[model samples]
Target: MATRFSSFVRCILYIYSFSTFLCLHAHEARETTESYHLHHTHTVQVSSLIPSSTCTASTKGPKREASLTVIHKYGPCFQSNKDQLLVLNHTELLLQDQSRVNSIHSMFSNNSDGNKLRESQATTISAKSGLPIGDGNYVVTVSLGTPKTNQTLAFDTGSDLTWAQCKPCAGQCYKQVDPIFDPSKSTSYTNISCPTPLCTQLTSTTGSPRQCSNSKCVYRVDYGDGSFTTGYFSKERLTIISDAVDNFIFGCGQDNEGLFNGIAGLLGLGRGQVSLVKQTAQKYSQFFSYCLPSTTSSTGYLTLGKDSEISSSLKFTPMLTLSQRQSFYGLNLTGISVGGQRLSIPTSVFSTAGTIIDSGTVITRLPPTAYNALRTTFRQMMRNYPMISSSDPLFDTCYDLSKSQSVSIPNISFFFGGGVSLDLNKVGILYVLGQTEACLAFAGNTDPRNITIFGNEQQKGLEVVYDVVGERIGFRPGGCS
Candidate 1:
């Protein structure tokens, strides 16, 4: 019942956000918004919003680009028969503003003691919230606890902490299709203490330390979409295929709530102390990559480490190294082009904050300046077609495809640092409405973070690699088979 209610509430919120726009388009079609949700099934990833001085030689992986000689691959996580329509949201926009506000408040609020770092005493618990955006999260298979209990989970690059539901749950556990993870049955499970450094790192706000529940370290996380996961910290062995990440720390969520329906929980890949990437940095070389399957029916893969020499043929884009906001993977984008001509938007518009390549977001999002420039150019090229107007922010360029025999969409490109140019697939540029209409697959972000995202839509059929250690991302076309 909780799960059903959570899903229902999400759609209501999405409609509310674009209620005016949706009402305007009410006459044209009933599935305009539903159709948009059909193609994209990804979610928003957030790194730890809390600041912690946990990095040391033992914690931070070597600053060298790791070799991808032996690939560890997993398929997309959200593979299921269930319907995936949800309120499409992102970064902060997808979830609650209160969480972001609380994060900011923590940053400026005085710290209670002298032990914590920065905010002098002002400490913002790094925000890591996954708002239910759509049905598409890149699902991966992993096992936790001893004698290994396998779990199907979502892999999020934008998140840093990994967690799962565990038992001794009694009344606290949400009903799931699979058996609840019984920690007592596992030989590897160990409780985390409240006074430990890791517990202190899990503070809810700026100065407040993580609390102790039943003498064990307790952690609480709330998302922007009014969902949260709460549990005690535990240490256990995590198995990805055959590799065993021992002493792995993850939350044993008891009071967990939100958009997650089929999966057990999440696999955090954010750039933070608790992220799986940092935990496996020593063995995996602090880098990993994934190729999302072009369509929902096919299988996609997530690979840890670098690709072989054949990957040298891929185009390269230099990553913007952000020291303060280390949780995000920032890319230096110049501008975009349509019909082989670059848009007139200035590069400064893209530089509003930091552009990160995210697999969680289904459609690509640009700042208003960058988006307006590309929209204008595309409109110019698409003047022959009839325009459809909507208040829904995601649908900017809609066309009456019913009147046209076939649409010869022009080439679209994303310009980035290191002279890298990404040519997008035609199908990825336009989303189809129920039967007669089609809309652009991109959106304009008005976020203060103004973070431009090259979402999964623009990344279809491509083998994209994130070389975090070297500060760059590599892209090669046509691999999502």
Candidate 2:
């Protein structure tokens, strides 16, 4: 099965006896919510997604762009029919909050420590429980383990770390990704001592249990949706299709549910603390690119060898490089237009200098102002159609289901760096109710699921290329190979 990178948002509705109720089109606040799982089918192929090329060096300049190339790298998903990778179904991560300091202290304090000291420390831990928002520091990913024979796994650019399930897990495990991390066999596997920086920070809010120090390098991670994954850490063998003799730092996860129990581990694409990309690039060259399809993104190319595919016209947007954090790619968005009509929104969406271009996130979320601009423009263009009263539950732009072709919304386009524009068509009409042509707006929200997601729906029919070497992204109008 494909890694379940996308997460599901549950829905709850409130019904009243009245035939027409004053409907409140409840919308979930848009934020960079974490993912639940990674889904990949065994049939996914890299060649189908990327253009093949021989590795070539770029012309060195003050700032030279690398040649874009896709190398031939294959893994189990390519050869087998069974789902071989375990993935986390959903992740619940929050910026550490000072209020959680007490909790952190209790979680980190050794019970063997004096009770009075532990209580005092608990107060301190709670105060520093959550990390500051947008800081992009102090994050973690707990994987299940490694490939027994040989397995190829996808590395996610939007993730924080890459790890797999380890053997000898205390709880449940998945069948895919051979040979779980048997902590007993791995000589390098060692628990994070309670006083160590990693252990102190990671388990501070949860209160470090004495059991963790007993010699196992085990860890636990909880997500926002209530699912959790636990496993041990170890120095395992990592093989890159590009090269085999060398190895990189990887993890072995275990005892995870949803999607977390299947695959060897994750390939974190997020910027920070020596990710898989960084580690791998160090061995070869600091260069890689991803060509994501405009259609269903069942496949894409991750190039580490060369940059031969570099388009001369590729727009280079200025990036705000964050220190001590995973540096992310940003866009200098100029404006968004619908059917050639420009909206009156600020360029801050593009100019904020930190608009994270993360694939890990399913939605292409814009700031409040950016969102309003798009909504207003869409509503204006859609004025020709009769507006439905908020009382209707079927659609925010409700029309009698009997009415044929009553609503028409134009295709919206987002123009970004380097003359690149991502144009989304009726797909932006993006959501419909259960096969019927009803707007998604009418979907009542009781539990605030992810409503503002600029899901794959927005990305359909647009070719996107993430150039890691150039530190920029490129786009082409048509579904160019």
Candidate 3:
């Protein structure tokens, strides 16, 4: 009887130990997960969704800096003929965005050794013109040439060559608010000759073979959306807010066609040898920062030089430069937190395909695994709100809040390498289609191997600093203010 009692006591002890283990596991989970409250986000009003007539004040920065006002191409602040602006629906916008993404992927997949340089040859000036501008691009005004003619151009971090439609459009030129640049009028304009080192760089810059048009180096850039620009590779003076950069290599397109939306041309802020950033490296030290306004009606600032006060408030992360793609700026996205809870996504999921921060892409793209976790968690937290259907295939998670006077959203943050945690602004979390058709601003890539993109939508209201010399990218909150 004593032996039987001892066995029974051993069985009771085993059950007690198992129960204790279960309780500890549950407690640990609870500790790791955090809850969110509505007070963490700003209340978004439906009336504010409409674009305001007057432009909001530009983000204040240091005086004497090479700062340019950034205006959304579709916003009211962009003064242009109403007919020039094409009203693209959400579906059309996503289509154009996908086109740009596809082009980037193609560029990465088709990486190859550039063409060999040819023998030295003279340059012949030719009259040519081309179209410019992309959907959802931002425009900035700058002076060009000896007389310094004001020209509004779209700024792109994804492109390398800076080009504008030059005068004497013997071939084809699209309509633009500013008169096409006349090289004859500017004494400073000079065509780049063939076989020159600067001209050979176009092979890598445009991803096209070097061509000489009547002894002049010819450049042809084909965008993903079927937009093409072919023009003489030339040099001219580029002025940005009183800072004049002489001998700036740019494209004087003679043949161009695209939906430029009345913009003169493109300003390449990419990380290539021929990009504006590299051309002005001596003056700016390869340092530049831009703040995208939260709303279309608001104004933002793009500064070329670093500001001491702004630099102090920034949180930095290591910038990655992949061998296959050198012009694009890369970043390591470690994890994401929705409603204050960090999703249980593996680091390998993000590291496999890699990530890039693009000023052109509108919506952020995530790996399927990471996106699924984020979407599921976001849906659970937003369960109280009514779910709505969206016609746009890109946006799947949408909520209807027409009845509510104010929106109380859960806080979302992104954790990057080097312990950098960035809390997104309220505008970044939800993309308001209307009062009733609000949706999460993120989307999932079809394949996990596809590279992730951190789009400009999430970058609104924050100052994004690209320090090429330091090899780091920094983010500061409330930069648009």
Candidate 4:
């Protein structure tokens, strides 16, 4: 009798434990489904990309992939008649970068300043076009809405929120190639409520509070270039390659102002949820790669999902922590080598705090200490060449290229942390200003507050892979064109 009672009790306990375990499992799954269903989504965990959790298992038939043919900013899309025009273009672009740096300063600034601002003062905050100041060299045409409203947008790895001009503007809107996206015309459009986690993610920026208008989440973005876009946060089906992704959250900007003159919107490839990469993570496993053609006449492409080909070819280094300004990808740049001679600079000068790889900025900017070391070493190597003084702050290291003799630019290499080094030739290190002139594609960032940007110049013809799961970025030499 005693043995039977004990066995009965054990069985009951086992059953109870199993019931609780099932309940917990169901609850967790429900939460995940709810979060994903909302479409105003969260960032993808690298762990989630594993084979078991990938979209392949559940997706029937062949997997659908989207590709965008990227055009160069200065290429045929924005053709110029004069070489001087290209020179002036870089000057203006650099000024835009300065403004972008200021915006970063504001983003990482003491929240106490933001906290101190009266509720009214913090309200305002957020534009781009034909390879404009806020844009990168590559551009893509993105289609959003049910009937597939196509808009040409600049691709930016530094920007977070993906926004576009929408119809029924209360204040201001830009002149885009296509008419504004009418959310009402789309069957899949829906406004996000303030109570949802998506709203919290959108408003998490300092001083960018949660503002609900007519029971919808309203967002205002202030970009690095002082461009501002204010609109409602909503979800809609974004069509690409005849395939559509439903419930993609984006900004419906009614008042978007700034350098965005001819384009429709921005395709934010930043490391944030509001970006295109993150939005498509569940379907694509948050893996995306791009190859930028060296020149404007060539074509490059952006691919979604894992690429076994690119991965095998890349050599990678761990990405630094999100110490500040979460959008930028921080990496430890230990030192630089000019003509095979490493610059004797302190490691602290390459602190991960103020270093990033940006897709938009054309020229690289390093801390004054690091820049001077690189410049001094480079100039020493090129003592034979005639130096051309420049009054423009943008082109500091100009050289007279009018001479028939080509400057034998020594091989320059950048050393980053974790045994990773990037070797750049003259083409990658210098931006030729017409046939008569050329300049070192680097700037002295005297302001300690600003971070060093690994700009497009350094990234030319390299297949840079952002491996979020591994927390590393890989680079490989390739003919992108």
Scored by lDDT, the top model is: 3
Task: Report each candidate's C-alpha RMSD, comma-separated, in the order given.
Answer: 19.2, 19.5, 8.4, 22.9
Better of 2 and 4 by TM-score: 4
TM-score of each: 0.71, 0.54, 0.85, 0.75
Candidate 3 clashing pairs, residues 3+ apart or interchain = 128-254, 129-254, 130-256, 131-256, 167-181
Ranking by TM-score: 3, 4, 1, 2
Give me the runs in candidate 1 sitting further than 4 Å from their true place: 1-136, 170-172, 175-177, 202-209, 307-310, 390-393, 403-405, 447-449
Q: Per-residue lDDT of 350-391 in model 3, one digit per residue for the tens?
A: 887778889988889898999999899989878878889975
User: Which segments of model 2 are wrong by more than 4 Å?
Assistant: 1-154, 174-221, 257-264, 293-298, 322-327, 348-354, 380-409, 417-420, 424-433, 437-457, 460-463, 467-469, 477-481
Give Cα-based local distance difference scores for all models: 0.60, 0.39, 0.77, 0.65
lDDT preference between candidates 2 and 4, better one: 4
Best by TM-score: 3
Poorest 10 consecutive residues by lDDT, candidate 3: 120-129
Ranking of candidates on lDDT, top first:
3, 4, 1, 2
Give the RMSD in angstroms, all C-alphas superposed, for model 2: 19.5
lDDT, candidate 2, equals 0.39
Pitting candidate 3 against candidate 4, the one with the higher TM-score is: 3
